[model samples]
Target: MTRSPATPLPPPKARRRLRETAALTQTQLADRVGVTPGTVRAWESGRTTPRGRKREAYAKLLKTLAEEAAVQAPEPEPKPKLEPESRPQPQPEAKPQPEPEPKVEPEGKPQPQPDSQPQPQPVAAPEPVALTPAQAFDALYAFSAPALVRQTFLLTGRREQARESVERAFQTAWEHWPEVARDRDPVGWVRATAYEYALSPWQRLRPRHRHPEPPPADPGDRTLLNALLRLPPRHRRTLVLYDGVGLDLPETAAETEASTPATANRLLRAREAVAGRLPALADPQVLHRRLAELASNERLRAAEPPTVRRGGERRARLRTRAAIAFTVALVATTALTVRTAPTHYEPPVSPGQAVRGVPQRVAPGALSDEELELRQKLLDQMQDGPERLSPRLE
Candidate 1:
């Protein structure tokens, strides 16, 4: 007869769970397994594995505990099902019945009879058509670009930069259409990109942006914009995402790449700054409304999809060309350095002194017979040049 295979032990974590589920302590399990408590701890932590008779005993105990745990595990709630969909209802048995005598109709009246026919089945709805990449990109851009631009405006407080930021972000999305389309939230992807670009630290280095743009005509709006610009970038981003964009704290933390507590700290500080500047606008709801109004009131507009796609293609081509050029230049520079570099060191030649000056040497005039003849011939050729070569075409 063939022997049965030995049962394998569960994982380290599962071992601890099995022990706990059985209401057994490490020491108790150690005694049952014929080992010390430290050995049990090591086994549970995956630091060591039991062997020989000990291994079989431990496995057997774990198996029993696992069975108990399975018995104690709660079952999932049952799903409600439709009778027609889930299965056909049980039909009642047919029985013989006494036939009633037909009544005679008076003067040209016809008797009615019941119709025997099965009801028609319900038809399922047709599946929706999947979108092409270009079409999907167009839809995403048309839906989100305008509002994304406005949100970026709130972040940077610049109408021109906000429009630029949104356009750049959309262009980036078009370039990576496959990845963006597969993303769970394409809108969020574009929004995050636009927000980061709009608030980039390098943007401050531009000469035109050295000073703040002209303030809004409304004093209230001007105060709010100034207050937002005054706060640090992280604090402002957290506040805008949490309050302005209506994102929950966890989402805001995730997008900002900060811990929940840190994000909360930033939001609190930002609100205090804005509230300090404008006392009447202390409530977060009011602030959110004001930010929306300020963004909507601007004349910001996005370029069309075709324009954005072309721009993205152009930018990509430019980058590719630049990379090629840089590589060629680097190769050329390396070749030149290698060719011109001295392989061996040489002592410098000392300048010859007068040595009480032997009479200064003189040479003949620069124009030799061949040089004079060549110079004369060139002059004659210029004088006899064709009229087409004349300075005046006429």
Candidate 2:
């Protein structure tokens, strides 16, 4: 017959045994349980007991330690035999005590009670801070010009056009620094602005029919740019700002002038579209290589001096400046027209003295629509006068 091995016995009821079994110094365990070595000594001496879960944890811990150490427990001492007695004696019964009465407080007097332990209070979350306009602008320019140009190329599918668009956008953003700088996502803001200009009526109406070739990827990056370029202008801008650039929803929405939910939807659709197209493309490595090549080419292109490519970028800068000047001129002209237009004040026709129709004097500058209308009305009134002025006697 097989015999079962005996289970190990517990260690001696001493503080040293606890310290050794728990693999902790008496001071360490006391500190951990928020007690002192003196209290631990009382527990180990059996003069006091550990309370609650800590006692169970410590007891089980010691048991596990003994098993791991493979120590054999000594046999328990045998109880002494009792001597036989001749006769039993009757014992007296004790009477039951009355229950304690509840305490009552007098009216209008508060009862004093011991203070309880303090409850833990929750900490408030820190607030999100906003960035200043100047700071925002600085952050945007902090991106290397090459990186910005590469991002533009990936979004637009044409390297030269992308570079031109980015340059114009930056120039415009710089000119309106105070305004664009207020934006939380200045990079995204500039990107969207570039997309708008690239798809503007003037650009669409231009005679050139050149189309962008699909970008060739390099080692580090290989995403195809064509998949993104095929999206509708707004969707493309939204996707490029979110997925390509890694802007959060709020920032993307602010940049695109779209609601957060709308921006999220656009990004989802854009991603789905790209994912759908990617399967047919077969090798993802090719796409990554093409993107890397695009980035490297963009870096090289940006490093070139502006004077060398003055023909293209110079024209772009001139066009942007002209557009700004024209916008300013248009606003000023509109304001002047509104401010100088003649007020429609009818000269209170004099109470008596043959009140004839009055003629209006045109302003020194070009005639305004208001002035023309007033003159026409006065002419009609004069033509209907009671009698013709005998040709205004000289």
Candidate 3:
């Protein structure tokens, strides 16, 4: 019997390690392979695998890249040998110094005793748990979901929208759990994703159902939250990322998709707007404290696990209906306005003018004094009176 070809390497681990070794981001690798970033992510996360020509191409590309990397790697330089003159020399033995004698204390004077050695403080070790992919996702969800939902709520004034955005973001994280688990700042990644999702323009177009009113909060907090919602979305998001989420300026800028200077300007303008609404916010410490309290409250709330089945189809259907309704209403309004609008600038004609298709003018010489006086009065009325001229009969 013919021997079977050697089994292929596991694609997921090989693809991830190869991409890392080549210092290529998922986006970069996707670009090189002429595929979408999501496809690469799915492949790395084991959600899907490359097949047929694509598989062969992927394996070939990785092998070529690994070879190029190995060839381009720099050789290690050899260490220099030490010379006899540079080596440490042995020294002749020296005589030991005499110990100083302690003086005796005088009679009736108390002698000083040596201090007792301080005991070492015990250090608490971190819990050691090996995180499988599922466990890691669970831990991240437990830690970050509530806070992310709250952050999204502050960004989008609607509580339901905020919850939806957070859920979608977390669902994405779960899809790419392997990569997210290996990320340096998984929480930050999820938070940023949720923030972007909350701010998506498509979300604004979707028809929203009414939600139950929230429980009573501090009047001051309500005032501040209302003011925050009134702010431009960019400014509000920037402020929340910096103050509420405690991200540094650069991180906030990155999340907001703004330059550092622009982000700084937004933050400054947001602060001023808030201060204008709430005088207490003029004090930086007071502003910071309030934001911290809001964040703490959000963190303390319970979080539900994200829905396993994403609501993409439902949202898409709703969006389509909304678009159709908007279009129909827009067309109807335009038609109504056009139909009712005044079509011509000229006033209605008298019977004589209608028959002649022109206005009949009287000569000054043909007019009686009364008629002339009446015409002059009409002219004066036209120039100064508030009442408009009415059409006359012939």
Candidate 4:
């Protein structure tokens, strides 16, 4: 059976009236509607409209309250009034209509005829207004941050890393706002940054991340996520951007900084690896579906737009302070270099050290008197007699 469309909700003011007349507080209404008090408030205040089953339930509830109000407050009885007698009046005559006449021309002068065809007027396009850095940052963050957080989470199955990656990307974007804002695809710029941060080899070394995060509750999800994680980093990224994020081949290649064929190869290998584990996901569509479901099912939500913008600004300010401090340090180092530099030419100091470990030999004494006499006798013997050739037979 086809389900009828949900009843449209009443105006915000009338909706509030219905709730008030029904003596229901926002909390009470929210409880009955299966939503939060804040959602109910937003509904009544017209900040947002309720959707799906919630919308049906809310519409039915308001309709019931209105009907009840109508029943309880009956209409008042009609009152009688005095009627006055009246008389008839006069009639009038029709007048002749004036017609458009052709103009008369003087002899020998040429008469100009009106153009039968209508000319089209050119329309000036409205000028595009430029956004300030903060506004642009907020806009970009709002558009891409949530999906990015999820994408990062898929890339590295860690929630904290996912959030941190996006925030860091936006921070970097804001830090280099001029370049980023000027980029043809700022979202792509931010996404690339976030992806790089998320996929950094160093992130795996984080103390908290050393142990794998808890897997999805569903066995299939757990298996799929494990399969995704098992792929090489490059392959996994290509798969996520290609299948999960629905990016085309060339765009995925561009984002991954690889040639199209290389990206295709990585994707093929990644899918094969994933399919090896989950044979049902061998088809690309099924793989994409599973990847999306895995990412979506996680309890991932990014910070509000303002919070992200504020964080980006905070990071930008920190970078500015760091640059200023670095400049000051550089200036100080330069001054110290100038002050302590050698005043004049100087010989280079030798760095060589005496060789170690070998024994130092003592030169023979010039003479103890006996030793000198012995030495003189030996010298005389060598000069006069044949050299004393052998040590005594020892």
Candidate 5:
């Protein structure tokens, strides 16, 4: 019997590992394969499988990319040498000063020595205590609110909208504290939600209110942030999620509602765009450091914890119930009004007379010639109305 063909490797694991090994982002791999980033994510997610020619092509491209990466990889740079003077040389000691002569004590009374003051010991800061779920949500809101607001501002390019989005997102978290507390990254969820809310078109429909001006951006961040803002919204969001927010590829993908491959592609494109606009960002280390600094600055500027009340969910439920009750009441009242209110007046028919299709008896009275003539005229007018117009020929 002929030897069987070797079993093919599973696409999801193989794709992920190969892409990572090659240091190629999902977007980069997609570019090479001429497929959408989502397609690559699907491949890695096992949502779909490659087959026949596509499978062969995928395997071949992965191998080629991996090999190319290996070939082009740079050797580690040597550490810089330290100069002798720069190596922390010891300073020479000064000669001891001549000692002062001791004064003799007078007569019989013992001389009292000078009283020494005790030095104050340095106090260490207390470590933060672990918080309960409710406490944690409050702390998270206090610490994260400003950063989230700033991030939203960057995304929305409007201070008022950003604040609204952040507030809405936090309120949502507050109302569902248990669920939010259980989330692996509550801050990330909040940030992602705020970003989504900021971008929603419905927000534009809300009544506008005057808001205080937002704080100024850091001088260092201004140029880079402006350049980032110039990118397409998707690209900007991806970059912020990855570098600014410090989310992993998968997390960023989920937050952005994109497939892993698509997210990767957006991140790659975002970086490229930013690098094109700001040459310093072309160096990954420099870019990472800058993003870290920006994130740190935002954290440092977070508002102090304020008193927070619980029962946000209860309040929301109450509001919902109130709205529903009001609607029902309004509907009932309108229905009652419609039922009881007097309708347009209609003439009372005689007992022997017919009104529409209902027969009634008429009163015994003889009709005058003028009355008959008036009735004929009224009938003539009804028959001569617009509906009796003849159709015009073209």
Candidate 6:
């Protein structure tokens, strides 16, 4: 015989009331109580009763449902009232008054008047001092941009790129002269600016260039220093800032926009990358000496004045501009003359023509039309031959 399906427990009195107040269907009540719709209907119709613990739980559920229903139901609104009527009154008349006369003072005596408050005059503000680029450079130089740059390079391991970033930082500081000049620590502002500039996209866009070879005169310092310089600019920046410049972990992290732990990890890895390649740098004193050399070298100095005659310089500049314009116009005219000049034509070369040739550098007006055509055709064939001609040849 097949086994009969087990009977579901009956719903309790509280569950029946909860289901009615909740406006839940028999199926909804059955699903919540873990019973069937038929069982919920049978219990609500008083044909069955729920057992022990389920009965107690159902009572608590009914109480919560009733409370929810009470909160959600809307209250009855108040009724409107009728208005009362009013009575009318009387009108009043107008009255006129005479004009007052001006008073005359007795001989040699002034009339008394109300005390008048004195008005304060506005004060003028002082003018701002204009800063020259040279002055800006000097102020930033004392604060150690070179050391900051070298440190950034050591940290990032990209020397040339880092230097450009540092140069750009100095340029920006120069542009913000008024603010930087007033700072209690101008050097700190410059260093922070340089470090932030290095992290920007403009730094990444700078043309990559060769790192200068370590100064050979310092043989004692060449090994480790050379390897350090050879590393990529960003890594070099990181190492320099953390190890060479003696920045604490948090400061290094701040400049690099990295966590202190990440900064420490980078420092460890950079130290290892250079340790084996340069023996001198392995020694702490050697490393310090190399850093000192770099710090002294990486500074922005004032540019030397251009050589020019002192008196009547304005007239000299105008004369120079005139000469440049005149030269450009002459060259343009010559080009037009040459283009519009008549040209002799030549027929195209025959197939497999065993052409004998002399290779010579042509002066501006040396080549005849046929010669120029032949030379250009030969150049085009050489440059765009085999790799590009396969389909056309077939």
Best by lDDT: 1
Q: Give residue 341's error in model 2 in angstroms.
A: 19
Give the Cα error of residue 224 in candidate 3, in Å.
Answer: 0.5
Shift of residue 237 alpha carbon in model 4, Å: 0.8
For 1-394, candidate 1 gives per-residue lDDT tens digits of: 9966666878665787688678787789889989987788777655468877888999999988888889999988999877776787799999989887556688756577676698999999999999887788888889999988878877888888989999998999888888778666688778878888888989988886977677788887787888888999999889889888898885676567554578899999999999998987789889889988887777888889888888999999999999999999999999999999999998899998758758878877788899999998787774756556447566
- Can you give the TM-score per candidate against the true fold? 0.59, 0.38, 0.46, 0.54, 0.47, 0.34
Off by over 4 Å in 5: 1-133, 157-163, 202-220, 295-318, 333-394
For model 2, how does the per-residue alpha-carbon lDDT over 1-394 read when each residue is reduced to its tens digit? 9955433323223334545555675567667667776665555433356656666655656556556545545667999766557446678888898955545577755556666799999999999888765455445655645666776666666667667776677666766677556444456556766766665657655555355454455422344455666777777777666655666675566556544567788877776676677764334344345445555565435433233234445666888999999999999999999999878976777566665688877668877899999998888774656665566656
Residue-level lDDT tens digits of model 3 in 58-169: 7778888778778888988999999999999999899999955555676756556677799999999989978776666767778887777777877776677777777777
lDDT for position 320 in model 3: 90
Estimate every model's Cα lDDT from 0 to 1. 0.83, 0.61, 0.73, 0.82, 0.72, 0.60
Candidate 5, residue 353: CA error in Å? 16
Model 4 Cα lDDT, one tens digit per residue, 192-310: 88988888889767898877677789998888888888889899999998898898885676666554577899988998888788899999998888888988899988887778777
RMSD of each: 23.9, 34.8, 28.1, 29.3, 21.4, 31.4
Which residue pairs of candidate 3 clash?
none
Q: What's the ranking of the predictions by lDDT, best on top?
A: 1, 4, 3, 5, 2, 6
Better of 1 and 5 by lDDT: 1
Q: How much is the lDDT of residue 281 in candidate 1?
A: 76
| lDDT (C-alpha) at residue 94 in model 6 | 61
Task: Choose 1 or 2, whichever is better by lDDT.
Answer: 1
Model 5: per-residue Cα lDDT over 289-321, one tens digit each: 887665455423333333233344656888999
Which pairs clash in model 5? 27-265, 37-262, 351-360, 351-361, 351-362, 352-360, 352-361, 352-362
Candidate 4 steric clashes: 0
lDDT of 6 by residue, 136-202 (tens): 5564554565566565554334555556556655555555667667655566566666666665655
